[model samples]
Target: PGVWDVAAKDNRGIMDVAVFRLSKKYPRANSVMTHNLPDGGHVRVASGPDGMASIWDYDIVLMGVSHLTEAMNRYRAGLGEKPGRSFRPHVSEILKFCRQSDGGRQYEAVEAALRRLKQTTVEIVRRQRGKDGRPLRVTEGAGLINDYKAVSHEDSGRVTSVEIELPKWLYAAVVEAEHPEVLTMHPNYFLMTPGLGRFVYRLARVAAGKGEARWSFRLIHERSGSPDAFKKSSAGIRELIKANELPEYDLAEEPGQDGPILVMRFRGSFPTPSTDTAGP
Candidate 1:
């Protein structure tokens, strides 16, 4: 997503540095695509009674997972485990990560995203890649989240903390990374316009390793589970590059007779989280 680039506009850069680790990788988050994830998540979004993918955005799940990675890293570095799940994240911490504040509107949005994450059920099974570079086909299903709780102060009336439970699939994926980098994202990722650009960033975080990776427009469209037609999808990619929204990853379009190919390059390293703690 154009998160890191977008974040520069807001000036809140105190969040922890995030990296794309195996556990954080999901097969395009159709929530489908694969990265170096120890076992890429084979996610299939379930349709609600309305016949559309649940009002779900992978960003919420990504935010929580990113924090979980941070906490887990701290744990391995000798930090004590918090209560409930092996990883516990404070509401404020999550808010800061998602580029939101304790303001009523932002707080409500955070609560709603948390609920969507907990209520929406996805058919997600994780599989390891075979030695020959093929996915070990498997069919198992689990919810993105098992349970969650939020607490608010009665007087000031703002959510102060949050607790979440991950199903077996997620828990396994988190600890699966042999050496997790705990990929950090721009706090602005959550603020992205819900569409192709955000999904592209997720893939770049995992797929575009220390160098560059290329994908055909069709591949990105299919991976993103976008509702737009092929022509429209192809156009979107060019628009993204022109807008310069994707600052962290360098993106360019390779025009083709058949269509267009997206070339994304990641220098693989980002600036350390800024110590300027001036904004939310």
Candidate 2:
């Protein structure tokens, strides 16, 4: 287990094994990173290797998730063929499924996010014992899109549809029919503004599972890639608790010998939204 994507030793078996599987999957998602964070703003962890990442402030990552979810769901439910690196869908379809604001500006926003997805890249490393009883590092680059295409009208120059190339790693996760390893995102996920609420929600969804999940400030900060001072980071958690921003889960802070520990437990059964989750 020396090559685990996450350093399991850090948690000493306290963290759920499933949570560690979130590699850009966030419980099957990829990790995130880019800048420094502070007490008042997003905390950016200064330590760690290049692979550490946190949920992005913008919901664009969700946008990409929306696309990935669709094809994967279809494949899982036996609706569509297996997906290749490229996933193609229309602009309107992407909008409707995500329940996003519609208009020229909104369309433009999607376009911008698409650009970022193509550019953003994630490096994935997995571990397994080699034949010689040695651990191995399997590294692959997980870019959001390997290729992309947008069909636009000649006269208006408006994009009509889109085609995106998915990284191989993502395609494999979605196609893993044996364990059904897909992450189920909440319907209101897209509606959530990019901030502590969404951030906490993601961590809960990915790690909390169907029961109580515990994370220390250092662990969350490590995963969060937050740069805030320790006290400031704890304060940020308090703000989420008071606001009650997390959905389908309850947040509680307890006094630990070191400091306060954050625990997230299932509020009850998570209710799936009745919104349109399919392409139009």
- Which regions of candidate 2 are displaced past 4 Å? 1-80, 126-128, 154-157, 273-280
* lDDT of model number 2: 0.51
Candidate 2 lowest-lDDT run of ten: 1-10
Kindly list the per-residue Cα lDDT of model 1 for residues 159-267, writing each as its tens digit: 7776677666554454454543345555545677635666676666656745788777877766555555878777888888888576378898887666788888874
Clashes of each: 11, 23
Cα TM-score of candidate 1: 0.67
Total clashes for model 2 = 23
lDDT of 1 at 280: 19
